[model samples]
Target: MSDTRPTPIRPRPRNDARVVTEAAELGTVLGIWAHPDDEAFLSAGLMAAARDAGNRVVCVTATLGEHGTDDPRHWPPERLAAVRGHEVAASLAALGVSEHHILGITDGTCAEQPPDGVVRRLARIVSDVAPDTIVTFGPDGFTGHEDHQTVSRWATAARATAAPRARLLYATTTAEFAGWWEPTRHTFPVFLTDELPLRTPRSALAVELSLDDARLDRKMVALRAQATQITGLIAALGEERAREWWSSETFVAAEYAESRSSWATWQVAA
Candidate 1:
């Protein structure tokens, strides 16, 4: 039998915001990402929202994102892994996540085929934690990075073996509106979900969290706390200004769900 699964077709966002409300409190959620700041950039708000709604959220990062820093002053290869690991721990805490696990794969590269031992280890963790939902990079890896792709692939496989009842969600890009696309470069921004434009046949479920300016400010504060990653950008744009730029986050559900239609409770609009 083929490992690939079918994708679902979902509805476009309604002009009416009332059609969607806050998602029901999920029992437990596991977010698997390739790097330190991936959670903050892509799903911090969702994590915050979930936590506020009383869900247990945990993170599994595949790599330290050691290759991502531009400042050679702080990130020599020898110390990058350790530094980024600490940063991941700190960042997840800021997001209200109490539990975190790092697979400790190589910073720039991951195993072409993750070892059966690695899979078993991840499976054991998942079985113990037993999250109701698993979120990770889509098949395109958001920008088709090999490491991100590898983690997503492994997360999917791990979901099957570890917790078959868990809902698996591959985080994907949504239609670009606002200044989301790289206007100057005429491409997707590097190292973020803002760049991918391809559409998959997968059923997509949308989740939107509405926040007031005060809450948004708090979110941005948490974002800026990860100094190793976005410090320069935060300095240039100022904290609140940068938050305004990417305040509203969007994600699409791909594979792992029986029907996209059932995800409507997770959707909320402005």
Candidate 2:
């Protein structure tokens, strides 16, 4: 097959947000995430918009999120894994994303896996995709999930090792989102953590997309597809609040991520 690599991503003008409805701003996009609903909660709309724009959008999920529950008795690992695998398919379909990779790393075990092996495998995928933009988690891992952290490290190293020219972005909450969700911070945990999350202020955001009515509806549908994971949270937060919670997608560029001294290092080789 002929190489279809896109042009490297250039810096966008400050204070200007790319209309998600437009194509080429993000180029062919590759998303690397930790669990089944990570992509849905973070970048589903972005992925769908890119696909609609005719860009190649590939998704890589690290685990099935088998332990993503409050009741292990009713939701055992094996059973949850099977169900989540199917749910992810439906979820991705709702977003119009057809290319997906499920790296079968066991749930809750990524931090223990040998980094070199994981990075090598991810590097292979990066080399194959040749995406102009790569999106994943930052240092805080969104909700400080160990799996999210490990995946972030692997994805970053892989990008450095195999596709350094690609633009890198980390999914992050904006200050607005932090404020909007502050009231229920303890009542409703969006991801795996109960701690206050790190946010990227609006001024520093590279790409922030507030889904329009149509896109927000699509995102809700995609998120709802993972009923086993999101149903209860939606019920507790109420539909409107739940919708408002994820209606916007925010990401910071690699330079911003690197600027944080605590999250500074990027592995040069797998």
Candidate 3:
């Protein structure tokens, strides 16, 4: 018998605010990301919303963000890692998330880590936490950052090995947002030209969370908690634009199938 399984079609992006509400019903939720501020930048609203609804929200960061600072006179690389570690914890706390884990991988060097080792560590974390929902960067890394891409791969691998049934989502932006935001270079010093335009097709997006004022307030607090990295962002975007950008969050659902090997191969749900 020739293998014949119908390929799953990608779902069109809809205003699925209900998904966020449903996620709160899930017992455990995990947000995995590359560096200290990633959770704040991408998923703080969702994290805060989920936590407020009484779900156990956990965040896992892959690196200490040692290379994040442009000013060595103030933050040397060795000390920057520890500083960022504390910052991320504070960020999560601001979102009402009390559980967090750091993989201790070197900042700016995630792509250099042994793939299997990285996957294994993440798998262990997933197994221990057993989240019902897992969120991470899409392939674009939201900014084309190598660490973002590497962590995305690792998170997918870990999900397959440790929590195949978990609902997997990739943080993303709509093409409309990309076109409007990319050309204006609204993300300047924080996100450079080469790093951006990481938007996904609207047709592929799965969820959109329209944050309420309270959730937006928490998100702002979380972002401010990462002061070392976001000072430039606040200065550049100004308070109004920054609030506009942070008012909503979006994600694309990812689908995966078990391969001939023990692992799973992931693709956009389209």
Candidate 4:
């Protein structure tokens, strides 16, 4: 499977500390993820900030999240997929993102598809979007789900093949947050803590964005829109703890051809 992964056209060292604080430097930003609510949980604040800063924001979800139902007995896979799709749209809307693409891959089975097919599909979107920065899950997938891992690989490969010059960023959480959330993992019907690949070391983090009150408020709205997924999250972490956990977004610079100084201009609102 490693043989099928697309090698970076211009590989460079992963840790580049230069922070991005300006939207102009970021230009158009694209976020790719495996499931519907992923953007909301992982990068909604960042997306909203970019959009508010007048940068074009686009999102691509690889699956409808059919398997994410906490009440499968009532929702089932098909019904849950439909619901999640609508939820994702509303969430993105709250973040001021109107452009999005759905790949329609089967839920919980993204890794089963041929790697080439996934790469091709994402590559086409990247080519069309032509974004300055591309964001997606890192190798750990943040949750350690096979689908998440698969999407991470596909997105990275797509960037390599179709948008080598674009700056690639991976959504991640700090080790401290992982520790705080670890004990509460079992509260969720899905995505157990033990199963999740949480926590990117602080050393690997290249950029950290702290959301302001208004941005955090918007993030909460986007998160609440995914009622099905958030019911347990809110109950487990409580509103305040959950907010604390989500207040900051972190990323590791994966690949880029631009100079560190140019990337440093992109900023996240503090």
Candidate 5:
């Protein structure tokens, strides 16, 4: 479903204080994702925005994306983990995110067993950081990946026990409508706003960040720093096309519990 019609663009509001205050400025933000580049896609803008506001941002990726890609001649599983790990570190550095950790979970194997230990590991991180906010995939795991769902489960359980006061949010996607970039059919409306019904929790608060080409380029550069996967494709696409692919970061706050009396960025239950 594409909108072929042209529409006028309205300017975004310019209340600096309002914008600053409205953006959730949590004391610490812990982003738990299923794979290496998952956080780079969904949370980079928010993380950059958070860091700009002086908040600590930590990322705990569940796996190294060792199962990514099909180039047998290029990347075997044994090499993929270390290569992607370095790429993750580089990407994090580019995005100004300092705290990065990986859980060493086997990629594509999250569904084969119970996740008690995963839950414990997540809880331990929660206990240590005690983040004011915890961000991860929604129950549908964004793309319904078992690893993502398992990670979400473990994150929520950890939030419940170790950091009851921490607000929980989910990173989501525009996947269903992410198909409008067909170069031959690149109508602006259809290409940009043919959004899908975001499949995260219905009550999740939607957050959108609009960026200029420069900011988008910065983000793409951060993403491109992950040479293990995106490098070849991004180089093929060129910067403008790459920017189209990387612009307008979106998210949803799936489980933020407002604390009773605090004016915190994310209100966590006591």
Candidate 6:
């Protein structure tokens, strides 16, 4: 039902000098995200849990999310980009991920970029890291955002070239999460199309995370670090709802989706 990797040990101080166990048991985790806060919203718990278990976690942001705002006059691209750079650094730091790369791709334009060039650049990172696991959006882009879909395409190509053995997990919603999201979905019109967001069943998720208080609190900290992005949502939903909303995370394995009927097996797994 779920992936074979186990959750890493938790709660030790970041300064713990104890020698870590063989990281290869789960191996290095690489997250390639379209924007800064996407990582926090979709996979913070998973990444934090991996780090707690002593895995090396690396983050890659394709863009600075410069165009993510209601008022461009107040938040121009250059200014927003600078702010998001700091926000992403602080956000990743909160999850114990110090190694990060920003590809400097302009926000909201990934679909317009040359695919071969982008794929080559991503392939270089894959070659360098040799990650055991790669996490990113699915073909749906998790919200049907064009930039996200482009990044997913590039990551898929890169992984096939450089880390074919690595597990590729795409952020996914569960049926329960989809039902839970109804009331709050209006507060955040993230989905670009009516057919967006393929939801997996809980039993079939490659990874399903329901964070404990400590981890959930830590995840909240990471989200809060991206204030420019998530502050309004938190305020609109109220802190309690915001916390409850993100308390869970889930994913689907790309291998199974390709080998079988896409998401059909997961639907039956329930």
Residue-level lDDT of model 6, residues 23-68, one tens digit each, is: 2344699999999999999988878888998898999999998988
- Over 180-213, each residue of candidate 3 has an lDDT whose tens digit, in order, gives 5765574363343433554455555556778888
* Model 5 per-residue lDDT tens digits across residues 136-248: 87655655466776777788888898998786776654543255344433432211222222422323334556666655665776788788777776676676676776666
Q: lDDT score, residue 163, model 1?
A: 92
Model 4: which ten-residue window has the lowest total lDDT?
Answer: 261-270
Q: What C-alpha lDDT, on a 0 to 100 scale, does residue 84 get in candidate 5? A: 91
Task: Return the clash pairs for model 2, or none.
Answer: none
Task: Estimate candidate 6's alpha-carbon lDDT, on a 0 to 1 scale.
Answer: 0.78
lDDT of each: 0.63, 0.80, 0.75, 0.76, 0.66, 0.78
Per-candidate TM-score against the hidden true structure = 0.76, 0.86, 0.83, 0.83, 0.73, 0.84
- In candidate 5, the residue pairs with backbone N, CA or C atoms under 3 Å apart (3 or more residues apart, or in different chains) clash, namely none
Cα lDDT of model 4 by residue, 58-148, tens digit: 9999989887755678988888888888888999999999999999988877867999988998899999999999988876566657777
Q: Which residue runs of candidate 2 sit more than 4 Å off their true CA positions?
A: 1-24, 190-195, 258-270
Clashing pairs in model 4, backbone N/Cα/C closer than 3 A: 20-266, 20-267, 21-266, 21-267, 22-266, 22-267, 143-197
- lDDT of candidate 2 at residue 201, scale 0 to 100: 55
TM-score of 3: 0.83
Question: What would the C-alpha RMSD of candidate 3 be, to one decimal place?
Answer: 6.9
